[model samples]
Target: MLCCFALSLVACATVPHTGRKQLNFVSDKQLNSIGAKAYSEILKREPVSENKTLNETVKRVADRIGKVADETDKPGFEWDVRLIDQDIPNAFCLPGGKIIVYKGILPYAKTEAGLAAIIGHEVAHAVARHGAERLSQQMALQGVGAVGSEIFKSTDGKLDEKTRAIIGALGFGATIGVILPYSRTHEFEADRIGQTYMASAGYEPEEAVKLWSRMSAIKKPPIPPWLSTHPADQDRVNKLIESSPDAQKKYQEVRDKIGLGVQLDVLMDQSDRQ
Candidate 1:
């Protein structure tokens, strides 16, 4: 237990953009290797979109976002993006910059800027190494469970099985109580960094707020912020709105210099119907 505590103290690392300290014992190479294997397995099971236009559009937007992320966040990641033929309104970026966008999300991400917002958010998660941090937290919790199990065994049935069960439940409850809030914090941080990435890539950061608003409108019953791994859509929208002014300024600066590259009106309109 003392050794585990010592290792955790030494493994503390700062998240990019947010600068929050997190316990991360996992190495990037190890995490990326795991992500690569999982991503390959997913590709085998799920159909990849053969729609050339959708694939091209996703690639275009992701490449722009990846450029900004490379400059500001993760320089060495081999960023690549693909569209899946799934109907689920979801997207994610795995470690080492493997990104997958679902076809169903295209409706909500109705514009190039909207797509940028979604991609940026997912890229922020990868850049922040949230997956590795979560894994490290789980490892620590498991270590705690192991220590507790050993101590309970030492009791040699002094406590009833029911008491042991209750203790285990309490440990699980505590871990959940801590980890869920941490996950929400990561979501909030990703929102902030994502807006910045979109802004840097010359997409309007305010579109992120609109994206979340659209998402909120579609959900029949929204998950409460405290209970979910992610913050509520409304909460995310509010935070994006709050942080967008600075991002807007950055966008204007980028636009003034580069003239707002990559207008995708036709592509966006076509994607919305799909």
Candidate 2:
């Protein structure tokens, strides 16, 4: 059974953000549930920000970026944005269109443009389906461990609490630890998409570079991006500079169309349906 499963693992998988090809053991359905579950748990643990102004700010900026994710071919997402009152300078979007932004990131994301960068990055994660993708990779790695008991074949056995916990933990580590930091490639890809999204939403494309410069400077204790799996500050800054022209053009086009039509409303409504 292990040998058969090993053979089957050779087939292709898609990296969420980059849409690059890779091997994945976790099924799309499985990964999605993992994200949905984790997101549900997170929402329960964290308090939703009731600051009406801040919530509106997050929603407005997130809405604009969502409208601008065309280049990413963003699947219709339930565009609900919540500002959680936590000081963890982090934000993330789950596979099922759930987005959470912690209060700590507010300072780093000063202006709306700065916030756009962060939103763009997180939304890029959802667009690329990075959470699901990472979870799938983890399931595959877990498969290697399962080789001992041929446990994967015994679906009933594998679903036991202990086994399920191990698998769940693997998926979590992939998303939070490995995938989050190691997501530079995903980050770079998200950066491109986010930049375009922000630009299309009337924010300057050049702001991404500036945002990263400040972001880079904020490492009270510095760590290597590649080694840590986060993006390299210099690399991100350089790419933003290189792509600003295209981003700027996209922004102009988006600006002209902003408030000119009701297409985005249709999108938001559709998100509710899904």
Candidate 3:
């Protein structure tokens, strides 16, 4: 068993920027192909925004962030960004570089710099291959569960009720102890790398801190950090603040700085008027 576990470590990959080692048993080509197909299906099913200005803004910000990501990691993702006319305040980047931003997120984004922070974070998730890493972790957990089942089998090769209950408890413990925490780790890592990406792309890194502050103020019931997939909003804001100095240095080095850039609310008001 020790030798087998050691052998699995050979499949570990290092995350860009962070240099954290991650297990990745999944094939990148297969995962990216799946991501591309899912992105295509989402485009067909979701309402793609027809608002020219919003679409342009999403593309522009996402492109700049994506460019930085590509240059840094050189993953060669076929990057595309689209605005979805939905009330959801969220954005995500699929494995092959499909970026989707919902219209509702604009108010929170507030400015191009804010949007860059958001997109940079999502792009970091893709560039770091978090999706594949997550899938690999799940597969590893399932394999462990299967092995446990075999070990706890009764004399007649049946799973006794006690054994089944124990297995279920172990699975629950793993979910709470291992899986959920790793998700929060991913979120924090994404925030760190995303802030850097925005800064490198010539957007002010402080916008990330301000953006999270806005997020923390939203009047929603909160889940405890241990129970949640994301770190608490305040915790995230604090982390961004702590990392701002480094990101700011990157921003300072950029030749073409776009500090805060265009105010998104102004564009929204104009769109509403027109």
Clashes per candidate, residues 3 or more apart or on different chains: 0, 6, 0
Segments in model 1 whose C-alpha atoms lie over 4 Å from true places? 1-8, 144-182, 221-231, 256-274
> TM-scores for all candidates?
0.76, 0.71, 0.80
Clashing pairs in 2: 16-128, 17-128, 181-229, 181-230, 182-229, 199-251
| Of candidates 3 and 2, the better by TM-score | 3
Tens digits of per-residue lDDT, candidate 1, 110-142, equal 777888988998888888887767666666666
Candidate 2: where is the Cα deviation over 4 Å? 1-19, 70-74, 144-180, 222-232, 257-274
Q: Record all residue pairs in model 3 with backbone atoms less than 3 Å apart, i.e. clashing.
A: none
* Candidate 3: segments with Cα more than 4 A from true spot: 1-7, 144-182, 219-231, 255-260
Could you tell which candidate, 1 or 3, scores higher by TM-score?
3
lDDT of 2 by residue, 88-204 (tens): 666766655667777766666666677787788767766766554444455565554331122233423225543444333332333233334535666677788778778878776
| lDDT winner | 3
RMSD (CA, angstroms), candidate 1: 9.0
Q: Can you rank all candidates by lDDT, best first? A: 3, 1, 2
**Could you tell which candidate, 2 or 3, scores higher by lDDT?**
3
